[model samples]
Structure formats: structure tokens, C-alpha cells
Target: MLDCKPASTPIEANHRIKADMGDPVDKGQYQRLVGRLIYLSHTRPDIAYAVSIVSRYMHDPRSTHLNAAYRILRYLKGCPGKGILFSNSRHLSIECYTDADWAGCLDDRRSTSGYGIFVGGNLVSWRSKKQSVVARSTAEAELRSMVSGICELVWLRLLLTELQLYKGG
Candidate 1:
């Protein structure tokens, strides 16, 4: 989509994408495109959430899903310079921020949880995934996200210690 018009955002905000909404599209093509986007998300955190959403319908992709995937491609074309930046800060501290929405998915009423881990004031790790269980309340959804974030933080701490880069709690 080099010559295609660029999209301002990767995905439309608050747009509910149902699995069985649009007509069926070529499964192989959609999967291959999303697979490439998944790899690209490793370096472009801006498209992580969008890529995750499109990756969900890889098994039985519809036209709606394909359009969303194209929007991500358009977004990438618009902002080619966007990427992660890791600076060498004098002080090394780990900070994780997480958030979740209650019943964000209309199809299954599953809340989506996301977290971004910053090390030395630069984003190092991040993830956006739907919770396995259906949370009855917003508080419950948020709690689940917090637990996931803490788990990642703990893992990162252990890794830093192993590499001799961490000295304090």
C-alpha cells in the first residue's frame, strides 16, 4: 500500500469488530499479512494493539478484519519513523503501567488488559491481551491487569539481576 492513502489511526477507536459481521475473505492472505504485522509489532509498539485485534480472526477472517489489517498498514506507511527508543540513562528503574476496560469485547464480554514496562525511562516491554475469564465488574478487570503487570515486572527484575544490571529492589 505504498501509494494508498494513509490512515490517521491504526484502528477506529471504540469500533466493535465482530467475527461474523462481514463476508469471508481469503484466509491465507489475511494470515500472512497479520503474521508480518505481528513481527513488526515487536519493534513498533504503536501498532501492537491493532495487530493483536486483527490476529484474533486469522482462523476465519472476514472482510472487516481485512480492512482493519489494511488500516494498520496504512498507519505504518504514514509514520515510517515511529519506533522504540532506548536511551542510556544514569539511573535504572523499572516502571510498569497497566489498564483494562470492562466488557470491552461485545461478542464475548471479555475485558482487554494491557501493560507497558519502562526501564531507565524508556519503554522496554509491553503487551495487550484479552482476559481469559469474564470479569463481572470493572474493578475485577483492573485487578487482573495489575496482577499480570506485576508478574512481568517480577520476571524483568530477575532477568536484570541475572545480567548483573540490577542492584536494588
Candidate 2:
């Protein structure tokens, strides 16, 4: 891993990612780097938003787009030791939180949905994906994201229930 500078936040508060319609560059290198970042996102939820944003421009990345991706790498260097930590605890309740940005994508006008799922106070799963269909309103987008979250919660609950049964609960 390259030594990188630390960013106060994974992404800029007002930063927005779009299709990089600028002049094309080496597509292979850009795709490789983006793929690495996506894998890193498995352990670093903080970079999820920024990575997802830059991924939209994989087909035609410009200098500006590459710079943004490099910034994330620098941010990662600062928090090299940061990762999900699990602890031994009796509490195994499943809970989740969901949020959405109504019409956040400027190009397609699709909403961005984010959700985090936790078990026994430890984050087990999370996501930041663009909604498939454009939402007519903010409430609609939020509701849809919540529905996705609920699905995750249900699956988690069932999995845990099976685990308990195996342990003779």
C-alpha cells in the first residue's frame, strides 16, 4: 500500500460524482484502481460514499476524476488500522438505520440510498447504492430505502435464530 495523507472526512460534504464526460485516459489503470478501492470498502465503511461516487465514472475518467479517487487513497493511509471490530457479548439483537438523498444523482436524477445494519452493537453489513428507479419525492425515496433495510434485518434475524437453535436455545 502507498503511504497516503489523512483526510478529515472520507468525502467532502458537498462533493458530487457524475459521469466523467471529459477526455478519456488509460481506462485499464482507472478500472484497476477503482476495483481495489471497492474491495477495501469491505472493511472501511467510511469510504463507501466516496468510492461509490467515483465508480460511476469508470467508463470515462478524467484527470479530475482520478484526483478524487487518489484523495480517497490518501484518506485510507491515515486510518490504516481502522476496521470493523467484533467483541464477545450476549446481546445479539438486530437493528438498522437507513437514509436517502432525494434526487442526489444529477445526471439520472436517481436517489442515493444508505443503510447500516448492526448485530450486538457491531456493524455487520451496510450499503450505499443508487436507487434503481427515480423517486417521485423525498419521502418515497426514504421509504424505499427503509424497505431495503427491513429486508436485510429480516434475513439477519432468521440467521441468528437458526444459530440459536443450533446452540440449543
Encode model 2's per-residue lDDT on 1-169: one tens digit a residue.
3645677776778776667545666888999999999999999898898899888888888776787888888788787798899986677767799999999988899998999998878899999999999999999999999999999888878787877722213
Q: How many backbone clashes does every candidate have?
A: 0, 0
lDDT of each: 0.93, 0.84
Cα lDDT over the full model 1: 0.93
Model 1 clash number:
0
Model 2: worst 10 consecutive residues (lDDT sum): 160-169
**Minimal lDDT window, size 10, model 1:** 84-93
What root-mean-square deviation over C-alphas does model 1 reach? 1.0
Could you tell me how far off, in angstroms, the CA of residue 1 lies in candidate 2 after the best superposition? 9.2
